[model samples]
Target: MNVVTRSAGIFLLAMAAIALPGCRPASQPSGQIITLRLSGWQSNPNEKQRLDYLLRKFEKTHPTIQVKYETINSEYMDVIKTRLIGDVAPDVFYLDGFEAPLLMQYQVLEPLDRYITPEFNLADFEPSLLNAFRYRNQLYGLPKDFSTLALIYNKQALAAAGITHPPKTWAAFTVAARKLTVDRNGDGKIDQYGFGIAPELARQTFMIKAFGGQLVDQNGFATFAAPNSLRGLELIVNQYRRDRTAAQPTDVGATWGSEMLGQGKAAMVIEGPWSIPYFKETFPALEFGTAEVPAINGKPGTMAYTVAYVMNRKTRHKEAAWKLIAYLTGKEGMKAWADQGLALPARRSVLGELGYDKNTLYAPFVAGARYATIWQAGKHLPTIRMNFNNQFISALLGEQPLSDAMQRAQDTANREISWAN
Candidate 1:
């Protein structure tokens, strides 16, 4: 162990000296009153307030335990890694699915298998989501919440284009997009784009998998340059370059897809559940509806983004940390947090109780969980993702052919991962 880790371990043993005092009352609890630190990126102000309220309830339920919550926003992973190396990291913290593999490989995370009990009901979580935190047959984290991509469209725009319903398949979606791309007032400038695209690998991974494309081989080298992968990606590039119907956020000077929609620059977008809360709060007057992602090559596909809570292996208050994690991801706490609709619950029971299955606005996202492609892979995924995003955007902008771009992306990613290993 390094000096920092050794010091932390020594401090943990030193803390045991003051575990119990002789002056303790008979009615008092046997264990020491401990404070467990939890770290995560905070959402918007309102959502952060809701989480604070929920944590307060947990503290009340377990009188002997106190939660010291901390929020890290900018460069989250960089700060977290520094803290971990210094042995000053929080006892529990949020880990994105895409980043989990690197941390797991370093063995910095506590394997949660032994901490989980039957009553905790590990099976209640969606298997696809839960599997993201598992490595080498050991569970390293519990997913707190998740969001899956779906088609969000403007109702009035579709009606103006003489379309009564959203597209159900890729072919029909293509037609709808063409019709929705509008040029009002004959200004020779487009008024609204057919679709707003992010053009990042985080959103395009499912498209790569839609046409029998494997993102990576068992050896974790990038396989996205394969013919099958280009076949699926060709549609996106063609739409953006040839059809002139689709546009990215920068084309309209918007920050993201949600901003493009809220500003009426795009008629449709493929986004996640967070869009609902955003639309309601920022553009309540805008009429919108959501539907399941259109099928690709007769196969249902979408992307799922998730974050999980994991324990630090160096934590001194292991039992207390587990108690906080268990409560935060547990049924009651999940229901309280997910009721706000900022994101969907990872737990089946919480989702059912929230009635998202019956609500039309939320139903499509709930249904997508069954076929959503989780945005996670091996430890080399970060390298692969960076190269793909850079090269794929070149294709989207008509600066390069899709096939050539992906070839360069795959080759570069493999070279970088090889150097990293």
Candidate 2:
């Protein structure tokens, strides 16, 4: 029997035995409780509190199971890898899409297909998010939540600049950005830039894809130095260097793109739904709005980041661990979790149930989910990302041409990947 069926049968038999006058079921381990260790990095205190509440609720429904949740704040993936090597990893844990390929490749994660019941409604999840955890045609994880990029612009700045609406295409966006940039007080220094950008690969990968650029070939070698990739990359470089309408967070003394927009150092940024509550709390009076990330070459594109609940292959209690994963990623639990709006629900039904598609600020992010490039490449992505970020920033700062920077990044990344293999 499948784990789900067996578990249900055991529960039903135990209930039947309890109904009899003095009969105790031999199959039931008298008052035996299984404790599951769960690990994830905490984004904030509220997220931790909310998860604790959800765990309590799950324990109530599955009375025999208790979950001990741990937060590994720093060096999360490094800690997880070490624990996996030591066989001391949590029974169930969070796995980011970017990191999933390596874990799945190493065969350290349990294939969840057998444990999944039809009633689990696996199809309810967004296919792209689910595909992130699949390897060799087998599934390994269930996405807990996700976020997609969108254009977040200052509403007041647009109006003041006589732009009635947010730009719908890259060309229009460039024009709008030029108009929005300002240098007040005749200081010769720009007081506000039109756009704030993160030059890291995570944010720029979509740009690579925007113009027929591929991050990796079928053989998983870095190919981002190809001419097509540079075409898209040069747009960013030109905007920051030639146009002078874009600035990085450090240039304006801010820490990230969202902070730059919030601080009025930039009039626009491409960000995700997490920035909504952040703006409301940090910049309460900032008039902001969101739109689908401006189309590139008449094609819409964005990036999606998702994290999943995956079972450790070595867990003693596979069934129990799956029960926790199921309940947490299930419709009810997901709805409750997503109600906090920390991230978008991975389940399509839960997203609709929460009415995120109707919310003005979140609708663009929701729309982008359909076409967003999942922020996952092959197993060598971490190495590729590191080299790309280091070199891409140099190009953005005008140290060298975009072509040279990308070629150097690609060559270095491929050498490391080849050595590792």
Candidate 3:
């Protein structure tokens, strides 16, 4: 018997043996407790507190089941993979879309399709995100939350620039960015940049795909060096290296785009829902607004990221583990998690109930999900991402032309993929 069933049998036998004087068959009122282990990476203090509150509520509602939560903040993927190989992984754990393909291919994750019921409403999930964790028609994980990139701009800076509204297209966005670039002290040095950016491939792939550019061919070989693919990326390179209007976080001595904007070093940024909490807590006095990512060639595009709660196939408590996963990803629990606006709800009903679609601050992000490119490829994506980022940064810094930089990146990435295969 499995761990959950074995534990249940032991409880029943103990109850029969210890039928004491005048004691009912069910020993204690609530009966024996079974514990399930869950592991995930640590985010912020607020996120942790809310999760704990929700978990405590779950425990209260289901008195017969208890949960054991563990956090591994540093090198999360490495730690999780190690535990999986060691056969000591938790019953349930956090999994990102980027890493799901590799684990699913190995068949180490439990197939969740059997556990889902009609009332669970699998159709409630966003289709693209839901499809990301499916392998060979078998559902393996349920997306707990998702975020799509949107235009985040400082309102005071826009007013200072004499702009009335956010840009609606690529041409307009570029023009506004230039106007937003300012030298407040007139000291021949920039006091604030127009845009703050990150040069990583994770953020740039959507740009590559925006104008019909392909990241990989049918065989999963790197193909982003093609002229058509480079077309969209050239705009970013021009803004950063030629116009000198945009600054990376490192250039402004801040850790990320959100920080640069909060510190008044950058007037605008493209970011996700997680930035909402940071902005409110870090710079309560700063005025900002969210808008849909600017359209490119009259077509809108952005990137979407999702995280799911997956079950370990080696788990001894399959039945109990499924219950925990079901509750967390269900309507009630997801609403409790997304109500604070830290992450958008993955379930459609919960989103509609929370009224985020009507909220001006979050509508942009929710709307972007329809057109955003998910940041996932084949199993070789992790390898391809590293090579692309290295050369992509070189191009942004004017070390070489965009075409040449992409060529070097594509060639190197393909070679690595061949070696791994």
- Point to the candidate with the largest lDDT: 2
lDDT string, candidate 3, 1-421, tens digits: 3343343344334434432332111222347787888988767777777778888988998888789898889979777876776667888999999888877777778889999999999999999989989999999999999999999999999999998999989898899989998888999798799989888888888888778899989898999999878988988888888888899999979999999999999999999988888999999999999999999877899999999999988776777788899999999999998898878899989999999899898999999989889888876787788888999999888888889999998988787666555
- Once superposed on the true structure, which residue ranges of model 3 sit more than 4 Å away at CA? 1-32
Give per-residue CA lDDT, model 1, range 1-421, as digits (tens).
4343344344334334322321211232476587888888977777778889988999999989888888898989767876876668888999999989877766778889988999999999999999999989999999999999999999999999999999999899989999999889899788898888889989998999989998999999999999998887888888889998899999999989988888988999999998998999999999999999999999999999899999988777777778889998999999998898878999999999899989899999999999999998797787798889999999888788888999999998887666555
TM-score for candidate 1, please give it: 0.92
Candidates, ranked, TM-score: 2, 1, 3
- Clash pairs for candidate 1: none
Model 2: per-residue Cα lDDT over 303-349, one tens digit each = 99999999988787888888899999999899988897779999999
Candidate 3: worst 10 consecutive residues by lDDT? 19-28
- Per model, state how many residue pairs clash: 0, 0, 0
Go through the candidates in order and give the C-alpha RMSD of each one to the true structure.
6.3, 9.6, 9.4
RMSD of 2: 9.6
Candidate 3: C-alpha lDDT: 0.86
Candidate 1 vs candidate 2: which has greater TM-score? 2
Answer with 2 or 3, whichever has the higher lDDT.
2
Which regions of candidate 1 deviate over 4 angstroms?
1-31
